[model samples]
Target: MRVGDVFLKVDADQARIEVEAMALAPVPTPKVLWRKPPVLAIAAVPGTALGRLGEPSTASPAAWAAAGAAIRKLHDAPLPPWPGRGLDELAADLDGECEWLVTNGVLPADLVTRNRQVAEAALRPWTPVFTHGTDVDLDVIRAWSSLRSLLGVRWLVEHGFDPTAPGCEVDVLRSRM
Candidate 1:
């Protein structure tokens, strides 16, 4: 939840972990592996997760735009280096099936909650989509890039790759206003 801290979801054996990522708008944070070989990504969003909340109109347009810009800058930070598992790689390592759900035997409710959470995450930024003067720009990309970097970082840590070395901290997380 801090500026550069990464969140994730790891399995029981810790073999496969999924980063919490937004798949476009109004979508719950899903497990998306950024790389192929290592299947690394940001840690799955913390359970009971809720990204930026509230609607744009609740704040002034300028404030909303500024908030959006800040989020972009956060996502654009450079990722730390690590040994990671790509999505498929993790699946393969886990034998192509995750026992995370079955192990708990509450998969049905879990799936439902996952769907709702995805919707919440997607709704975070898209609230302005249907409003007047809603527009997207490079800042959006930067936000996403920042998110990707976090994913990369989570991968590194989950796999025992340390990124705390000097000059190894996250980059690209600049200011908005």
Candidate 2:
């Protein structure tokens, strides 16, 4: 939530990760204003969003290049104290979630299958980096997005969100296919 110049993030698990990552990251991150369990307040960065999901990016090529450079810097930084999931673990989670999506009728079987195939490219071993959970490979990024959307469909619906809404996860997945 944003209140003027401050953005308040509320998530016990994520708050800790964000705090630790911000402290360790070499690139610019939002300045920490204050933090409490389940809530972290940070001063807002002075820039419009580069783009919204499911929308064309209006940012200049320089902006995109800069963003890529920042990501490269983060990837080159020292590994975080905590470890992330191993390849086998991530594959298991992906397969399990894809099965759930199909069994629960959360998504069409073909859609899940295709995305799972795409996600498989990410299951290969790669050196770990200080990433916020997702893999660094472009294939893995796309795969993770699909998996995350599949996982969130039920939760979003339960919370009164329409997953089919324009620019939402479902739409994004459909567009990618």
Best by TM-score: 2
Q: What's the lDDT for residue 152 in model 2?
A: 52
> Model 2: runs farther than 4 Å from truth?
1-18, 31-45, 53-55, 131-137
RMSD of 1: 14.9
lDDT of 2 by residue, 14-122 (tens): 4233788788899989999998655688999988779887678899999988888888888778987886667776677677777877898878888878777766666
Candidate maximizing lDDT = 2
Query: Residue 28 of candidate 2: its Cα lDDT?
Result: 85
Model 2 pairs in collision:
none
The local lDDT score (0 to 100) that residue 13 gets in candidate 1 is 32
TM-score of each: 0.27, 0.69
Position 22, candidate 2: lDDT: 83
Runs with alpha carbons beyond 4 Å of true place in candidate 1? 1-57, 92-98, 109-177
